[model samples]
Target: MNVVLSAVSGISASLGEDAVVGITIVILVFLFSMQRFGTDKVGLSFAPILILWFALISGIGLYNLVKHDIGVLRAFNPKCIYDYFKRNGFKQGWLSLGGIFLCITGSEAMFADLGHFNVRAIQISFSSVVFPAIVIAYIGEAAFLRKFPDKASNTFYACVPGHLYWPTFVIAILASIIASQSMVSGAFSIISQAQNLGCFPKVKVVHTSTKHKGQVYIPDINYMLMIACILVSAAFKTSTKMSHAYGIAVVCDMTITTFLVCFIMLVIWKKNIWLVALFLPFGCIELLYLSSQMTKFTKGGFVPLVLAFFLTALMGIWHYVQKERYMFELNNKISVESLGKLVNKENINRMPGIGVLYSELVQGIPPIFSHFIANIPSIHSVVVFVSIKAIPIATVALEERFLFRRMEPRGHNIFCCVLRHGYRDVLGDHEEFEFQLVHYLKEFITQETIMHEAEATTTTVEQITSIHIHTNENEVAHISHGYTIDDTLTKEGKHSSNGSSSGSITMLRVANSYSLSSSHMEGVEKEIKFIEKAMEKGVVHMLGEAEVVANPKSSIFNKIVINYVYSFLRKNFRQVDKVMAIPHNRLLKVGMTYEI
Candidate 1:
C-alpha cells in the first residue's frame, strides 16, 4: 500500500494519480508471480542489469520529462496540499482514501522477507533504488500531467501516442515483471518459514538454488497463485476492483505481527510495562488506519482476508496438532522421578557418556530419560544437554563460540547450547564455536581432577553427541505427515508390487513403533532423577524441521523387526495428513500418508 500511495501521490501530476495507482495492481501481480526463480537468475542476472537499465532509460527521459514543470515542486510542500484540498473537497479526499488500498497490499513483504537478502540489503535497496526512482518518476509525471492534462490519462497506456504506446507499455510490462519477481520470491520465503514453524502445512518444496535460501519454490503455492491471479484478474475486471481486496490481507497480517510482537515484548524481551505502553499505543494508530480499510470489504476486500485467514488458521491447527502429538508421545515415554530416591541409589548414580534428548519443543520433562534410567540402573556420570532451538533451516554457524557460553548457566558439567537457528547451524561445526567450546570446556572441566567414577579417581569424559531430530521443510518434528515410496507401495497393498519411486519421502513413524530407539544401559534408576532434570536443560538444542532422518540402513527393521517398536515409531512418522493451500481446499484425508 505504501508503494501505491507513494506512486500515486508522487506521479499524479503527469500520469494522473489514478493512473499510477491503477498501474500498481498489475505491477504487484507482476512482482508476486515471478519469485520462484533463483535470485542470481533474478537479481544478479536481471535485477542489477535491469535496475541499471531502468535507471539508464528512465534517466535519459528524465531531462525532457522534467523540463515541462518548474512548478512541480509545489506538490511536495505541505502548504500547497492545504490549498489543493480546499479546492477539491472531501469527495476527493475519500476517493484518495479509497484508492490508498493500493499501497498496503504488500505489507506482509516485510515480515515474510525478514531473513532474506539480509535486512540491510532490503533497506538499502528501498532507500537507494526504489525510493529515488519513484520520486523522479512521480515528479516527472506530475509535470507532464499539469502541462497537458490530456496526457494524464488514468490508463498509463493511453498517455502515449499510438505508435509509442505499445513500446512504452512493453517497457512498463517488463518493469512490472521484475517487481513481481521480488514479491513472489518473498512469498515463497515467508511460506517456507511458516511451514517450518507449523504456521502452514507440507508442500512439495523445490529449493530455488543451492546458495540462496531466499530462492525457494513451492509447487503448491505457485499453482495456487497462478489460479488466484487469473481469477482475480477476471473477477475484478480491473485493478480498481482488486484494489478493494488489498487492505484485508495486509491489515490482517499486520495485526498478527502486532500481537506476536507484543508477545515477544512480554515473554522474550521482558520489557517494562511503561515501555510497552509507550510504543504499543502508537502502533495501534497505524493498525487502526489499516483496519479502517475494511469499510471497503464488500467492494472486494473479502478475497485476501479469506486467503490469509485460511493460511493463519491452517497454521494454527498444525501448531495445535503437532503440540498435541508431542505431548501424547512424551506421556508414553517419560517415567516420573523423585530426586531423593535417585540420589540414594549407590549402584544407579550418574553415567559415563552424554545424554542429548532431542525433541521439537523439548518439553522440560521428557519420558525417555527416566525410561533409560530405569532400565540402565547403573548408568550415571553423564553430561546432559537441554537444547532450545528450532529445526527446518535457521542454524547458527558452529564457529559462533559465543552461543555455547550463552547457554551455560551458573557453571556445571552441564553446558547449554542455545543455538538461534534451525538444525544445520546447530548440528554443523563453526570455527569460532569450536575454538570457544574447546577453550571453555577445557577450562571448566580441567579442574575436576577425578574422572568417570570416584573410586578410580578420574572424571568421566563424555563426547558431545549432537543429534538433529529434524523438521523437514514442512516444519514437522518426527514424521507425522510423511511416507516413503516403499511405504506408499506397500500401503497400496500389493496391487503395484515392487515399484520404486526415487523421489518419494518415506517417513518413518517416530512415536509409533518404527522410529523408536530401544537400547538402554542397565541399573541406573538412582541417577534417573538427574537425567530427567537434564532433559530440558538448555544444552540440548534442536531445529523445527530438519533432514536428519531415521537411519536409512534400518531397512533391516523394515523387514525383520517390523512388529512392536518399529511400528510405534513409524506411526509418528507417517505422512497421513496434507493441507492444500492458496485457495484452501481439503483434498487428501486428514491422516492419509502419501508417497512422492
Candidate 2:
C-alpha cells in the first residue's frame, strides 16, 4: 500500500505526502469495501487487468533488454553475486539482501490461495506466465539501471518510455491494488481454515460463490486487514521502510512453510529419510534469508513480529481451551445403556418430533444430551445425534459423506450420525442438509431391517437342513432399497455340492417364507412412517451452549486465559448455531457448564 502511494506521488508532482496518504486511505477503504462481492467476482474483473499488466511489463522488459546492454543478464551468474559480496564486504551485502527479499514477498499469496484454485492451475500460471514475466522485468530493470545508476531508487518508473508514462503509472496502481487484494483474500482463507480446525475463534464466513466452495468472504477479517494496512501505510509513510517489514514477514512465512512441508514429507507421507533430508539445505537457505531480514528489526521488521506474536498467542489460547473443552465432553459422555436406563426409570416423556442433537462426538452420546433430558424430563421420539466432522481432504464424495449407526437398545429409536466433509467442502443450507439427513436415516433403517431378516432366515435354514450354509453377511447388509430374495440369496448363500439344487431351493423357500411374512418390509415401513411423522412434527436442531470456565485448581495464567480471554472471545465470536447454519426457528440451545 505504501508502495502504491509512493508510485502515485512519483508520477504526480502536485500531490504532497499528506495528499498521497489520503489517497492511499481512500483506496484501502474502497478496496476492502468491495470484498463482500467475493473473490470470484473480484478475480474475474481483475484477471484481465492483471494479465494485461504482466504482458505490458514483459514487453517493456524485452524492449529494454534488446535496446540496452544485454550483458546485464550476467547478473544471473553466481560469480556476480560472489564478486559483489567480496567487493562490498559481507555486512553491506547482507543488509542489501533485505531489499532483494522484497521480490518474493507476494509469493506466499499463491500458497494461501491453494484453496481457491487447483494445484495444476496455480503451477501452470506461475511457471508459464508469472515467473517468466518477473524474470524479464527484473533483468530489464537491471539493464536500465546499468545505463543510469542514478535512477536506481526508482528503476520501475524510470525505465518506462516517456510517451507511455501516465498509462504505465495507471497500470502500476491497478496491479498494486490487485496484489494487495490477493493478500487480503489469502488472509480470509487462512483464518477461515483455522477457525474450522478449532485453532481460531468462530467468525462469520460467507460463501461468496455458489459454484466455487472455497470462494468465501469474511467481513470482519476484510475490515480488520483494511484498517491494519491503512495504519501501516500512514505510519510508515514510505515504501523503503515498509519493504523492511514486508521482507521479514515473507521470509518468516517461507521458513514456516518449509518446516511444515518437511514434516508432511517425513511423517504424513512416510517418505524415505534421505529424500526428506534433502529439504534441509533449502530450509537452511530460508533461515539465512530470515536472519538477514532480522538486521532490519530496528528499522521496521519488528512490526510483523509483534503482530505474529499476538496472533499466535490468540490462536494458542483458543485452541487450548477448545481441546480442554472437548476432553471434558469426551470424559463425561453418557453411554447409550445409561441413557436408556435413565429415560425408562424416570418415565421421561418421548416427544413427537425428531430432535437433531448437534455435537462434536462421533461415537458415544454427548453429556449435553443427558443434561437436556435430565432438566426437561423429555426427548424427541426419534433422536439423531449429528456430528459434523472435517476431514483433511479437498472434498468428500456425497454418497460416502454421511455414516449412520443405530444406537443399541433399538427400542430407544436413537441413532448416531457423522457427517464427514473435507476441508474445502461447502455445507448446504439447513433445508438441504435436513432433507439429506432424513433420506439417509430412512435408508439406514431399511438396510438394517433387511440385514436382520436375512440373518434370521440364515439361522432357520441351518436348523431345518442341519447343513451349514455359508453366506457373506456384509453383502446382504449393504443391499439397496430394492430388496429381492433372489438377489440377496444369490450374493449371500453358498450351496453344498451333492444337494446343490436342493439346498438352493431350500434356502430360497426359507427366504421366501420370511419375505412372505412381510416382517422386514413392515418393520422398515413402520420406521419410515415414524420418521415422516416426526418430520411433520418438525425437526429441532439442538446445539450445546457450553459455558467454559477454568478449573479452580488451574494456575493464574490459565484462569486468565480460560475464564477471561477465551470466555470473552467465545461470547463475542459468531455462535456455533450460526456457523452451522441451523434454522433459527428450529434451533434449541442446550446450556451446559464445563469446569476445564
Candidate 3:
C-alpha cells in the first residue's frame, strides 16, 4: 500500500494523474521482475542517483535555513522538546508519536544488509551521507511550515522549489524502489539461514554470482513477496491506512532485535551487568513507541502481528518435527553386531560398483539399509554410508569435511563417510562432492596398506599381497568371534599357475590417477586399479523414503501435528535428493512406514 501510494503520489505530483493506479502497478511489476538480474549490476546505477538526491535535498535545506526564520534551530535544544511534550500532555502527544515512529521504518535494513556490506562501511554512510541529509531535510520542511503556516500538512511538496519538484519526485520513487529491494533481499537471507539450520522448510536457493559468495536468488520468496505487495497495494490504496501496518511491523522488528541483542550481551558476550544496564533506558524508549503504536491496533496495526504469529508458529512446528524425526531414526537404527551377522549369510550376492547410502545416523547403520538387504539379493561390491551432519558453527573448513571410517577389516571395502557442514556452509555440486569422496577414500586405502605392511614385516611380499587380495573378497560379508577373512579365501576362486585370479580379476584398462607413497607400489596399485574399475562401473544413490504417521492411540493434538501439519510441510518442502543435488538417473529409494 505504501509502495502504490508513493508511486501514485509521485506521478500525480509530477506527471499529472491520468492513470495513476495503472502506472503504479506497472512500475512495481517491472521492479519485481528485475529481481532475477540481481542488484550487482543495478546497485552502481542507483548509487549516483542517491548521491544526487542527498546533495539536492541538503542544498534545498541550506537555502531554506537562510531564507526562513533561523529560530527553527531551537529544536535541537532538549528543554524545548521537553516543554512542548509537557504542554501537549500524555494523550495528545502519545497519539502523535505513532506518526513520528514512521520516520525510522526502514532502519531494520541497516542490520539486515550487514552480510552484503561491512559494518564500517554502513557506519560511515549513515554518519556522513544519510544522517545529515535527513536532519537538514526535516529542518528545511519545518522552516517552510513555520513561514507558510497554512501549508503545515503538505510542506514537503509545497516548499520544494517550483522547477525542482518533478526531479525530486523521480528521485524519491527510485529511492523507494531501492528500499524495497533491500527489504526483499534481507527476507531471502533470513529464510535461507533458517532453512539451513532446520528452523524452516527447505526451499530452492540459487547462487547469483561466482565471485560474490553470498549473492543468492530465491525465486519462491521473490514471487510470494511480489504477490503480497500487490495485494496490499490493492487493499489499502492509500498511504494513510498502510502506515499503521508498516509502523507495527517496524516497531515489532526493532523490539525483537533489542531483546536478541540484550540476550547476546548477557549470555553470549558475558558483559558486566552494570554495563548491560545502560540498554534499559533504550528498551524503555522502544516500549513507549510500541505502546503508542498499539493504539492503532484496530486500524491495520493487527496485520503485522498476525503475520508474525503465523510465521513464528510455522517455524516452531518445523523445528520440532525435524528434531522428532531425527530422534526416531536414531533410536531405531540397526546395530553393527546385528548387521555383521546378516552380512555373513552365504546366500547374499555381491554385485559390481559402489552404492552410496544416505542416512541420518552418525554411528549405527540405518534400519532402511537392513530392509533393503533383506529384500534384495545382490549388494554392491563397495558400499559407502554417507551422513551429512550440520554443526553449530558458521562454516566448516573444506579439509575437515570428509571423515572416513572403515566399518570392517581392511579387505571388506565397506566404509562410513561423514560430511560435516556448518549452518552457513555452501553445499556445492554433486561432481565436487564425489571427487572429494573418492580422493579421501584413496588416501585412506594407502594408509591402511602401509599400516598392514608395518604389522606383518616378517611375511614374504607375495604372501602379504595374496593375503590382502584374499581378505578383500571374503571378509566383507562374514563376522564372528573366531572367524577371520583369510579362512574363506581357500574355499574358491584360486588363481591358476599363470599367477592370475579367475574371472573375478579380469583385465581392464587402468587409469593412472593415484600417486603411491610406498616403494612396493605395484601391489597397492593393483588394488587401487580394481577399485577404480568398480567406480567406472557406476555409483548409485540409495535414499530412505520414510512416511511419518501418528499412532492410533495418540491424542488429537499429536494426530494433527504429526499426521497433518508435519505431512503437509514435508510434501511442500524440497526433497532430500534435490537438497543434496544427487543425480536422478542413478538413484534408488527404499520405502518405510513409521508411527510416532
Candidate 4:
C-alpha cells in the first residue's frame, strides 16, 4: 500500500496529481492478482532492476556530490555529529532523533526476508553495493539540501537533475513495487512459520515454486494485507503521518528480534558471556528508537501497537488452548495394558485386515479409539496406532523418522508407530506412509523369524491347528464382506486328508496347516497378505473432531475464552485433517464434545 502511494507520488510530481489515486489502485490490484501466479517468473527480473536502480542512484549521488556542496563529506565525521548534538542540547536533539529514525524505516524487511536467500548472498550484496549506494544517496541529498536551504522540504526531487527526473521517477516506482514484494513475501513466511509452530491457525498454503520451498502464497493473508494497505493509504493520504506508524512498527520488530537473538545466544548456543553481552547495546538502541517513536502516539503511532496486540492475543490464545487440550488427552488416555485385555476378551470380534488409527497421544490409546471400538463391533486383525510428532529441528533423517513398539509379544497383532518430523520436513502422501509402514513390518517379521531359528524352538501340532483356525477366521471375515466360495470348499470337513488348495477355501485353509514350521511361515505370510489387502482396500483415517466448550460451573472469563473466543478461532481455522492432507474418501471423523 505504501508502495502504491510512493509510486503515485513519484509519478504525480512530474505528471500531475489528477490520476494518481486511480493509478495507485490499479497498480496495487494488479500486484495482488499476480500473487497466485507466484514470483518465480518475475523474481529474477527484480534482481537486475534493483541492481540498476542502486547503480543509478549511486551515480547520481556522485555527480551531485561534485556539482553541489562537496562539504557534505564533513557531515560524516564523528565530531560533526557531536557538535550538532551539543548545539541542539538534550531535549531538542532527542526529538530530532525521531525524524532521523525514518531514514531506516523499512530496513528490518531485509532481515525478515533472510529465509528466501542465504546469509552469504545478503552479506555480499549489502557490503558490495546496497550499503554504499544508500549511504551515497543520502549524502547526495544532504549536500543538495545544504546548497539550497529554501528547497530542503523537497530535497529528493530537487536533487534530481531536470533531464533525469522522468527516468528516476520510473525507476522509483519499480523500486517501490520490489519493496512491496519483499514486505508481502516476509509476511507470508512469518505466517507460515507461525502455522507450523502451532502459534497460529492453519490456512491454505500454496507452494509457489516446486524448487523453492520458501516461496508460498496464502490467499486469505494476501487479501487481508491488501485491504489493510489500501485503508492505510486512503486514511493517511501522505508519507509524513504514515512514517510515524511505520517507524514504530519497524522499531518494535527490531526490539523483538534483538531479544530473540539474545535468547538464542544464551540458551541455544550457550555463547561466551562477552559475545552475548555485545547484543545488549543493540537492544538498548532499538528500545530507545521505539521510545522516541511512541512519543507520536497521538499522531498515528499507536496503529502498529493496536495491530500487534490483536495478533499477539490471537496467537497466545491458540497456543494456550492447544496445550490444554494435549494435557487433557494425557490425563484421560487409555492404558496399553487395558487395551490388550479388551482385545483378548472372548466377546470381542477380531475381524480381518489391518486398521490404522491416527492418535494424538504418543503413549497409550487415544479415547477416540476406545469409543470407536465400543461402537463398532468388528476390529481389524492387525491394528496399528499411528502418532505423528513434530520435533524442533529443520529435518529428520529417514533412519530416525519412525519408532515402532509392539503392544504385546507373540501374535497380539497390535503395534504403535511414532513418526517424527521436523517443522520444515515434507510429509509424503498417505500412500507413501502406508508403504513405509508395511515395509518396516516386513523387516520386523524377518528379524523375528531369524530369532526363532536361532532359538531352535519347534512348534507342536496344536500350534499348527491354532494357526489354521486363525486363517479360517480371516476367511470368515472375507466371506462376510460379500465374497463367494465354491461348493466343494463348503463340503470339506474339520480335518482334510490332503493338504491342497485346488478345491476351495477349505482346501487352502488346510494347505497352510500341514507342518509346525510351515504353519509359522504361513502365519507370517498371511499377516503380510492381510496388510497388503488392507492397503488395496484403502486406508481409513479416523480423527477425533472435538468441540471445546466451557463447563457451566466455570468462571465467566473461562466461559468467554473457551466458548466464544477459542470456539470462534477453531471455526474459522482449518482443522488438522485438512492441514495434514488426509484424503476425504478415506477420512472418518468421529465427532466429540469436550467441556473444560
Per-model TM-score versus the true fold = 0.53, 0.81, 0.82, 0.80
Give Cα distance to truth, residue 340, candidate 4, Å: 1.8
Model 3, 325-416: lDDT tens digits are: 88888888877677676677798887888888998766667878878888896688888898886554445556445656677644657887
Q: Residue by residue across 382-496, what tens digits does model 1's lDDT show? A: 3433333443442333322112221222222344333233322332232343344434343223111111122142212222122122223454222222221223222322211
**Range of the 10 consecutive residues with the lowest summed lDDT in candidate 4:** 476-485
Worst 10 residues of 1 by lDDT: 587-596
- After superposing candidate 1 on the true structure, give the runs of residues whose Cα lies further than 4 Å from its correct spot: 1-37, 56-67, 100-113, 150-155, 158-167, 251-292, 334-456, 460-596
Ranking by TM-score: 3, 2, 4, 1
Q: Which lDDT values do the candidates have, in the order given?
A: 0.46, 0.77, 0.72, 0.71
lDDT of 4 at 48: 83
Writing each residue's lDDT as its tens digit, candidate 4 over 1-596 gives 66557556755565555466667767777777778887786577798889989988998898888888898898878898789889999778878778898787667667756867888988898889888998899888888877788976557767889899888878877888888888898888888878867788778876676555677789999998888877777677666677788888888888898999999999999999799898789999878878888899899988989999999998988887877887777887878677777677777897656677877766667777666777775677777777776554445555345556567644767777776665456664777877787776654554344335433644432232212212343451111110011222243222222222223222112213322355676867777776677667655666787777888998998888888898999999787676668788767777666776
Candidate 2 lDDT over 285-335, as tens digits, reads 889888888998999889999999999999999999999999999999988
Candidate 1 vs candidate 2: the TM-score winner is: 2
Poorest 10 consecutive residues of model 2 by lDDT?
499-508
Indicate whether candidate 2 or candidate 3 has the larger TM-score.
3
Which ranges in model 4 have alpha carbons more than 4 Å from their true place?
A: 14-18, 37-39, 209-213, 272-275, 345-347, 350-354, 389-404, 409-412, 419-519, 532-539, 551-555, 579-585
Candidate 2 local lDDT, residue 27:
79
Clashing pairs in 4: none
Clash count, predicted structure 1: 94
lDDT of 2 at 561: 94
C-alpha lDDT (0 to 100) for residue 300 of candidate 1: 83
